[model samples]
Target chain A: MTADLFLQILVSGLLIGLIYALVAVGLTLIFGVMDIVNFAHGEFLMLGMYASFWGFALFGIDPILSMPVTAALLFGVGVLVYQVIIRRIINAPMLSQIFATFGLMILFRGLAQFFWKPDHRLVTHTLVGGNVTLGSIQFGLPQLTAAVGAVGVTAGLWYFLHRTRLGTALEATAIDREAATLMGINGQSMFALAWGIGAACAGIGGALIATFFPIFPEVGSNFILIAFVVVVLGGFGSIVGAFWAGIIVGVIEVVGGFVVGPEYKTAIVLSLLLLVLLVRPKGLMGKA
Target chain B: MTTIHLPKTVGALALLGFALLLPLVIQDPARQNFLILILMGAQLGVAWNIIGGYAGQVSLGHAVFYGIGAYTSTMLSLKLGLSPWLGMLAGGVVASAFSVAMGWPCFRLKGHYFAMATIAVAEIVQVLVTNSETLEGAVGLSLPMGNTGVAAMVFSTSKLPYYYIILGLLVVTVLASWAIERSHIGYYFRAIKDEPEAARALGVSLTRYKLVAIAVSSFFTAMGGSFYAQKEMFIDPGSVLATGVSIKIALIAILGGVGTLLGPVLGAGILITIEEYSRVLFGSTGSGTDMIIYALMIILVAVYSPAGVMGLLHELRRRIPSLRAKAEVRA
Candidate 1:
């Protein structure tokens, strides 16, 4: 391929990777703190997209302008799910826990279909609708904004976890639940916080991508597998690992699709996941 | 170890006798088709229970084996004009080989990780099947029209043959599971499920036993797939290899009570009946209603009774003094 085409592919991969990282960060965070893989996580992303879509289509508000509203809405949903269903199964068997989340996945998807119908919808004439030309390369403005939003959200999360006391307490609970409980940290609150933050991350990702991608109830399925691959490839519970792994997966998916065939793009990403899992289950940055 | 309780054995045999006579009594083609579906569900559930229930590995990607079985038999029949019976056996072997490759690497991870890995593997298989030209990709393959015969595993008019065939398959799977439950392998499987570390320390080769379980499980699942292909007269990646199919298989086992000899059979009967009825009542417009009901049932079962329908029966047996007395007498 020519240098310009290569650069275009590389940049596009990087942008898509950022969104994947954002979605995966939420999944990894929940897994890190509570050791529960949220199978309904993709539903949260779907909800976010719908939130943005409705905001744009019904109220004449741009998706970018309504990103916070979508995030807050998802944050409440995360907490509600924890309170209603997840809290009861916190100590249940592994199989039960899995089915519980899987059940939630079905419930949410079904609810979406019930309420909104199964037709695909998209946000048109959004604020970030045009393409930008930089020298020899051109890129969509929505993608660039979404990429920047991902970086900002990720940085803010990192700062919150590392610099703030509340975040430290949450991290401490993740490290040792009993010790954190002994230290007078409310474990329940921390768990709820993790869910809130996790859902918000996915919501932000959904809102950002709503500008460019089609929105549907089953849209979550399209990205959920890729997000899981990212979470595993980055290590089970490492944020930074998820970030870099997301980029790697994105690049592999796009470049592999270009080189081999687009139909096998998903296969390429999943194969990378299997390889990493077989060779290094702990992932690149995950603590052994 | 092969000893069977008299009452339970007699009860199961009576149930089997009833099932055998069902197709003859039920003349309506639609009702016969429903029974066939229930039998198929039972067979698939029993197959999954071998690994997911007995070995305690929650595989969400079992559709890989199912799809493999379907694709193998369909290709063999379409390409070489082979009998589906032989193709079915070939499908089972192919699926078992794939299972070994998958289970070896995936068995290392526990719980959700194992489940996630299985999903990825299934997705990979689906993608590969969808892309391959020989498999006809997304357009899929249809078996050529030919003379109906027992050897071809094709029947044109009556649904009775298909019902009996699947019923026979279900019986074989249940008997195999029952035999395993009473054998030394059963103890080893339970040990691994209860405590993997403890089982390993006691000289149980975790990988070997788990692989054996998954191999058996995948083989039967693939056989079911082959049966499904011949019965439907068509095979497609979307139909046979979808993640939804895998989830339904797991749900049937879970809902019936995993690891029990007859749990999957019972679970399959209840779930398939409910699913088919819901589809009939709502038609295509009520697209997500059946799923909502299934989801609610799964959540309720997981939260309230992880042991499923069998667990409820056990609880009932415990609650009633007369029932407890009869149970003690049987024991």
Candidate 2:
């Protein structure tokens, strides 16, 4: 392969990596603070795609313009889901929490199919066109936009989580929910906020992904597995870890898919995950 | 335990006799197929319950093991002229060893992480099956049925043989489950299920017992796959080892009662019946009937009774002890 083709693949990979970071960041946050691995996190991304799809078709809006509204809408839904369904089982049992999210995933996916049909919903006409050709490498406009958007959103959230009071409160709740309560902080609210914000990140990621990729009923499932691998590989609860891991994962997926047929790539990624997990169970960015 | 109280061995024999005679009584091909499917499901549920129900592993990937058994048995018998009856046993062994191979690395993570790991494992297996040149690469392998005596298990022409075969499997599975329930290993499994760290501290080896559960559970599960392959007379990776397949098997265990013996079987019977009815109604091919039935079962069981259908029955029987007493006297 020519150097230009190599540059093109790498650029595409880095662009996709940014999107992976956006999606995984929320999972990292929820895991970091709440220690709850919401198995239905992927379904939220599915809903976000549906939201963006409707936002464009019904309202005649651009994806970038509809991004915040899409994020906020899912944000509220996340808080509601947590308050109504999650709160009841927060202390019930591990299986209950696991199954509850699973059930909700089924429920949400069912709803999506019921309402939207199982067809690929996309914003084809309004797609950002034009390619940037630099040093014999072609970088598309959509790729550039998604990459920039992902990085900007990630940085903004990083600043918010690390610098803001609410961020510290979220971190405190994650550290110890009961202790945070004893310290006169509303741990419940923080959890709700964390899930809400995390969901927003998923929504934005979904919207961004839908720009270049097709959206099907089980599309989120495709990303969900890879995201899980990324999360596990990067570290269970580190945003920075998720960031780097996402990029590394994006590169590996593309490179591995190219080198060893698409079928073997999943095995490679999962085997990598298992290896990392066995060697370092605490995760890449996770504290031992 | 029933109206005619006999020796345990005799009672078991009588039940087997009844099952063997089912094809004779139910001459209708459809009913025979349903019965065979139920028996197959019952066997599978028992297999899944050993690890998922008894050990509380909640693997959403047992179908891969099942697929391994089915494919191995079919391939060896067709290619090497091995007896499928023997091939099935070998298939079971292969699956059990594979389970142990996977269990070593995966048993470290708990709950969702473990579940995802299993999912990944199954997906990788599916990919392997799909990509392998030997396996025919997605188009799948075709094996001739009923060639030389008992060499090939290709007797899907009549539902009677399948009924007997699955019935035999169901009996073996029940016996295995009963043995596990009464064994010391069963207690260690329960300990691991309810309290892992405490069990670990109290001299119980988590990995050892967990692997045992997985191996035993997978052995039967793989056998169920073989039985299914024999009955269907066609073996393919997609039919046996898909994500939906694992999810369905897990649902069967969850539906009946994960920990209790016979719960998953009961659940599987009901679930299979529902699925058959749905197929009859909706004519297969992603008909929403299965989803509707599954959703209802999940919701009702999850909300009203988290312990599942058998657990609900136990609770109801407890609440109305007079009904239990009357039943005992009637028996």
Candidate 3:
């Protein structure tokens, strides 16, 4: 490939990578706080996309304008899921925890199929429909805007975790739940909070991409595995790790697909996961 | 203890005798097919119990072994004209070898990490299989229907032979599980599951035992896959290699009771019945009602009864005698 083409592919990869990071940040946060991997997390992203699509179709609200609504809706969903299903299995065996989440994944997909009829819906004629040209590089405006939105939400989350008292309390719970409880941080509420934020992050990601991607019941399956790769590669429960790892995974997927065949893209990323598991099980940022 | 065991043994034998003769009495091909499916599910579940239940390893990518077995037997028969029975044995051996190779790196991880890695491995295998032209790719391979007999492992006329073959396979699977459960290896497996650190401190090699568990589990699971290939006379990544198939195998074990010899059999009967009935009722509309019901059942069971149907039976058994004694005392 020429220099210009390479740069274009690299830019495209970076843009999608930000969204992957956002989705994984939620998954990693839930894992960090409660030590439970939410398999239904991608469904939250799917819901966000649907939320955006409905917003546009019903009220003529552009997907970009309705992004916050999607996030808020997903936050409520996250909290509801925790209260109804996850709470009962808080102290259950690991196998039970896995199946609970796995069942939830299927439940969400089934419900979505029931409601949405399994059709793929797209938010066409959106505000960010055109392309932008930089001195030597050009890309779709929707991609650029989605990347920007992802960066904004991720930065806000990072700041909240570091600068605020509640965020610090949440972090404390993640680090040591018993100690956090001794310190008067209600572990249950903290778990609920982590799930809310985690799910909101995925919702934001979905809304961001809704302008470009198709909305479907099973769409979450495509991103869920990739999000897992990012989570594992970033070190479980590390936001900063997920951020960088997401970009790396995205670039590798796109560029690897470019080099090999498109069908081998998933295989290439998964091979990276295996290599990481063999060499560094804790991941790039997981604690020892 | 012998008093308690004698009746149980007699009951088991009586049940087996009934099962042996049921195929002859049940003449409908469709009903026979359902029985075959239940047996198949039970076989896979028992196979998974060794590693997932006894050894305390949650491998979500077991379809890789199933797929490997199916592909192996199909390829051998298609290319070299080998009998599927021999191919089935070959499939089991190949799957066992592959399990050891895959387990080498994967066994180092724990809990969710290990599970995620297994999914990744299975996904990669599926993708590779789907893209490989020599393996027939996504088009899949169909076995020759010209020759059909006991030797070919194909019965075109009726489902009776297939039913008996699967019944024999399930018996063998349960016997293998019973043998393992009665041996010192079973004790070591439980130790590894309940107390990994203690097992390691006591000179039990966790990796070695875990590998043994996976090797045996994968062998039988692959046999089931090969049987599926012969029964269907077609093999594809979508049918045998899908993650859904792996989950179903694990679910059967979980729903019945993991670690117990007969739990999977009970689970298979219930699960396959629900699956068939639901499909029959809602399959045409594609409304996903079956999936919704299935998902709800899984969630409820996982939440309320993690120990499964066998656990519930044990609970009932313990409670019933106490209730009877109280009633007698009152009288």
Candidate 4:
């Protein structure tokens, strides 16, 4: 491939990686704090895509403008799911947790199919229009905008976790749930918060993906697999690791796409995942 | 699961005899189709349970093994003039090898994490098959219409032979499960599933148990796929290796009771019947009603009785001693 083509792929991949990081951060955090793999993380993004679509279609709102609303709404959704369904299964066997999330994923997908009929929906970006050239290489302005938003959100989240009191408590809970409880920190509430935030992250990722990829009932399935790949490559439960790993994965996808066919990109990505696990099962940024 | 007492087992055998004779008794094509499907589902479920239930290692990519069985067997028979009987064994062995290769790296993962990884592998296989020119690209493969005879192990008009074959396969699967339950291998599988570290500490070889579980699972699953391919007289990467097929196997296994011998069959039978009824009676189009039923059954089964049908019954039987006595009396 030509240098321009390679550069173009790199830029696109970097942007996509940011979104992958954003989506997977929530999953990582959920695993970190709650010790549960929130398998339904992708459906939250699905909801975000649909929400953004309606925002554009019904009220003529831009996805950028609808982002905060989606985040807030999805936050509430995460909390609700945690309290109503997840909390009850918190202490149950591992099998219960896996099936519950799977059930939730199926239920949401069914609801969408029943309501929307599997038709794909696209929401046109009003503000972020056209493309820009950087040193003779062109990139879409919307993807750049999404990248900026993703980076901004990641920075903001990092700050929230590192700088705030609630964030420290969350970190404490994730580090040692029993110790955190002994210290008068409510681990349950902290877990709920992490899941809520993770849900919100999914919403952001969904809105960004919807800006480009059309929304469908199976869209969630697509991202969920990628999200799992990202989380696994990053670590089982590390948000910072997921952020960086997402970028690595994104770049790998671009490079791998050039090496293999586009259809085989996912397979190549997974093999890379296997490669990483083979060398280091705990992942790159796993805690020592 | 029903108790394994000899007379009770013989009585169950008599019931199975009467049930298999339904095709001869009724002879309606629709009834024949339902019975065949039930047998197919049961067989698939039993196949799936070997890994999912027995080892407690949920693999989401079993369809890869299944497709391997189907394609290998069918291709061998068509190209090499081999009997499907021999070719099916070819498929089973290939799938077993594939499962071992895939499971080795994957089984390093714990529980649901392993499940997700397997799903990724399955997706990769689907994509690979879809793009392969050797597999006829996306055009798919068609078997030269084999005549309805025991020699070809296929049928053009009659579904009767296929029904009996699948019944035989189901019986074999159950007998295999029973044998596994009593073997030292079964004890190792149970120990590894419940407490891997403890099992390892107690001198169980983790690798051997896992490989055995997955190999057996793949073999049975492969047989089911080969059977399916012959029945359809057509096969493809998309149809055989799709996510839906893998999930269906998992669903039926989960529905019937994963670890139990007869549960997989019972679950598969019920699920296939519901799907067939939806297609015929309810006139639900391709995938719509089937997917809905699948999702609902999974949710209800997971929520109400996570152990599935056999587990649910076992608990009921445990609670009501008289119920067991009555069942014994009925037997």
Candidate 5:
């Protein structure tokens, strides 16, 4: 392959990888705090895509301009979901927890189909609507913007978690729920906050992906599996781990697809997952 | 534990009698097909229960074994002109071997990690199968229609043979489960599930027992898959290896009562009936109404009845004597 082509592939992979990181970040956050994997997580991304789409299609508001509203809307959705369903399953058996989220996944997909009519919607005309050419390599402007936006959001989340008092409390709660409770940290509220923020992260990622990708009820399924691979590759419940793992997965997917066949890309990524499980079950950065 | 309650035994025998005689009375092909579906579901669920329910390793990627069975049987018949009966056994053996291989590395991870790894492994297999040329790739495989009989295992004239075959399979699975439940291996499995560390402390080989559970589970699950391939006369990755299929199998076991011997059968009956009827009523609109109902049922069952339908029955049975005693006190 030509150097330019390789650079192009790398850039494309990086762009998509950033978005994957954003999505996995939310998922890892929720798992980190609550020890529950939200199978409905992809639906949050789907909802965000729809949020952006409706904003554009109905009111002619650009998706970029509506990003914050999408995030807020999804945050409320996350909190509502936790308060209604997740709260009850906090102490349920792992089997029940699995089914509860699995059921939620189906429920959300069904609801999306019922309300949105199962058709693929897109924000066809966005402000970032062109291509950027540089040094014999070309990139979609929307992809670049999405990647940049993803980085910004991830950075903001890191700042919140590491620098803020509320974030520290949430972190502490994640480390030891009982101790945090004893310290007067309301574990329930912390869980609620985690869900809200987690959903918000997916929403932002969705809004970014909405710029270049088609929006549909089943779109979340496409990303969710990849996000799972990323989460596992990065080590579940580790934010920094998810960030780098996402990029690595994305690059491997694109480059591997290019080298082998696009049909085998998922197989390649999933093989990596199996390899990681066999060699290092805790993942790259997961706690021993 | 081995002491059998007379009433329960009688009820079981009666149910078996009803199952054997129902097809003779009902001639409707669609209803017969529905019955076959329930049996198939129950078979897969029972097989899954060995590892998932008894051993407490929640493998969400069991469709891989099912698909392996289907493919193995189909390939044998299509390529070598072997009888599907032989293919069925071969499929079971192949699936068992595959399960052992998969469980070796996967058993190290606990809970969700193991489950997710299973999913990943199943997905990779599916992708590879879809892209494979020798296995016919996405085009799938079809059994020849020239021969029709018990030997061929293809019954186009009537659903009766298929029904009896699956029912027989289900009975064998249930009996195996019953035997295991009464055996020391079953105790080891339960100990591994409920008290892993203590079981390990007591010198129980957790991984070895886990592997045993998966091998047995996958063997039976493969038989069900082979049955499906024969009944449908077709094999495809989409049909046999989908993650949805895996989840459905596991859910049937969960919906009934995972560890209970007959729970999966009851679960399969309810779940398949609901699934089929809903599809008939609401599937054409493409509005996903059936999915909504299915989703709601799963959610409600998971949320309110974690112990499943069998657990509810046990609870009701426990309450009846107390209620009767209260009435006697009042009198």
Candidate 6:
């Protein structure tokens, strides 16, 4: 590949990796807080994309303009899911937790299909409508904006967790539920907040990507496997790890696809996951 | 533990006998097909239970073995002109070998991690199959039309032979599970499941027993896949190797009663019935309704009774004194 081509692929990989980071952060946070994997997380991303698509199609609102609304909608959904389904299985066995979330995933996907129909929809016209070129490399404006949005959201989340009292409480609960309870943190509320934030992150990621990618009920499945790889390779329950891992996975997927074959990209990413799991189960940034 | 419960044993035998004779009595091809599906579900569930239920591995990528079975037998029949009967055995062996390779690395992880690893492995298998030209890639393979004989394991339209074939497979799987439950190997499996560290301390080789369980589980699962291929007269990666198929196998076992001898059989019967009826009721327009119902059932079962339908029955029998005596009398 030419240097320009390599740079192009690298930049594209980096942009997509940011979105993957956003999705993985939500998953990691949920897993960290409750020890539940939240298999329905990808469906939440799917919902976000659909939300953005509807906002654009129905109201002529650009996805970039309606990102917050989509995020809020997904936030409510996340909390509702936690309240209705996850709360019941909070203390159940590992298997029950896995299946409960897996079931919810199926339910959400089914509902999405039932309500929206199965056709793939896209928001063709967006605020970021054109491509930008610099030094013989061209890239979509929508992708750059989405990457910026991802970084901004990640920074905001980091600030909330580190600089805010409520966020600290949430982290406390995640670290040690019983100890946090003794320290007067409301475990239930913290759990809800984690779900809300997690869902919101995924929603924002989805909405941003909706500007460029096709929106469909099963779109989440395509990204979810990569997100899982990111989470595991980064370290389960570690947000920072997931962020970095997401970028790494994206780079590998895009670069590997170009080098190998696009058809085997998923296999390449999954193989990396296996290799990471074998060599370092805790991930790069995860605590031992 | 080796001592069988007389009542349950007799009831199970009676059920088996009834199932064996079901095709003869039904006459309707549709009803017979449903029975075939039920038997298939039961066999898949039982196979999964060996590792997921007994050993507590909870693999979510079992469709890898199922796909391996289907692909192996189909390819053998299509390429080498081998009979599916022998192909079935070859498929089982191949699946078993693959399981060992998978289990060796994956068995080190506990609970959810192991499950995730299995999913990854299965995805890799799927991706490989989808990209390979030798396997016909995504277009898949169809059995030749001319061979509709017992020797080839392909039938034109009878459905009776297929029913008996799957039923026999189910019987073998259940009996194997039952025997394992009564044997020392079963004890080792339960030991590893309940307390791995303690089991290891007590001289039980965790890796060996876990490998053995998965091997047996994958072998039977592959056999079911081969049966599925021949019965359908077609094989595709999407049909045989999907993650959804893996979940269904585990779902049947969990819904019926994990680790119990007859739980998967019962679970299969209930689930297959719901699946078929929902498909019929919804038609093409009702794409997601059946899935919705199935998902709801899974959530309910997981939340309310982790032990499954058999567990609920056991609970009921325990609570009602008269029922307990009746159950004991039957035993």
Ranking by DockQ: 3, 5, 6, 1, 4, 2
Please provide, for model 3 over A1-288, each residue's C-alpha lDDT reduced to its tens digit, 9 standing for 90 to 100.
Answer: 789999988998998888888889999999989999989989999999999999999999998899888989999999999999999999998889999999999888888888888888999889999899986789889888888887788788889898999999999999999999999999999999998999899899988889998999889998999898898899988999999999999999989999998899999999999888889988899985
Please give, for residues B1-331, the per-residue lDDT of candidate 6 as tens digits.
6566899879887987888777788999989888889989999999999999999999999999999999999999899999999999999999999999999988998888899999999999998998889999999999988888899998886889998888889889988898888889999999998989899999999999999999999999999999999988888889999999999999999999999988999999999999888888888534688878898999999899999999999998778998778799999
List runs of model 5 lying over 4 Å from the truth. B1-6
Better of 2 and 4 by lDDT: 4
Docking class of 1: medium
RMSD of candidate 5 to true structure, Å? 1.3
Model 6, stretches more than 4 Å misplaced? B2-4, B322-331
- Local lDDT at B320 for model 6: 100
In model 2, which runs have C-alpha deviations exceeding 4 angstroms?
A: A1-3, B1-25, B145-151, B279-289, B299-304, B322-331
Residue-wise C-alpha lDDT for candidate 1, range B1-331, written one tens digit per residue: 4566899879988998999888889889999999999999999999999999999999999999999999999999888989899999999999999999889988998788788889889989998888888899999999877758899999998898898888888888888887777778888999999988899999999999999999999999999999999999998989999999999999999999999988998899999988888777777534688778878988998889889999999998778998778799999
What are the per-residue Cα lDDT tens digits for candidate 2 across B92-196? 999999999999988987876778778888988988898888987687766674362344666645767667777878888888888888789999999999899
Write down the DockQ of candidate 2.
0.36
- Residues A1-288, candidate 2, lDDT per residue (tens digit)? 887778777877787777777788888888887777776788888888878878888987777789999899989989998887776666655555566667677667766665677787777755675677787777778777877877887788889877998887777787778888898899778988988998998998877766767777678777777777778878887888888888988888778887787778778877777677677766778765
Error of 3 at A114 (Å): 0.9
Between prediction 2 and prediction 3, the one with superior lDDT is 3
Per-structure clash totals for the candidates: 0, 1, 0, 0, 0, 1
DockQ versus reference, model 3: 0.80
What local distance difference test score does each model get? 0.91, 0.79, 0.91, 0.82, 0.91, 0.91
**Considering summed lDDT, which 10 consecutive residues are worst modelled in model 2 chain B?**
B285-294
Q: In candidate 1, what fraction of native interface contacts survive?
A: 0.63
DockQ of each: 0.70, 0.36, 0.80, 0.44, 0.78, 0.76
Query: 2 or 6: which has the higher lDDT?
Result: 6
From the highest lDDT down, the ranking of the candidates is 6, 5, 3, 1, 4, 2
Candidates 4 and 5, the one with greater DockQ: 5
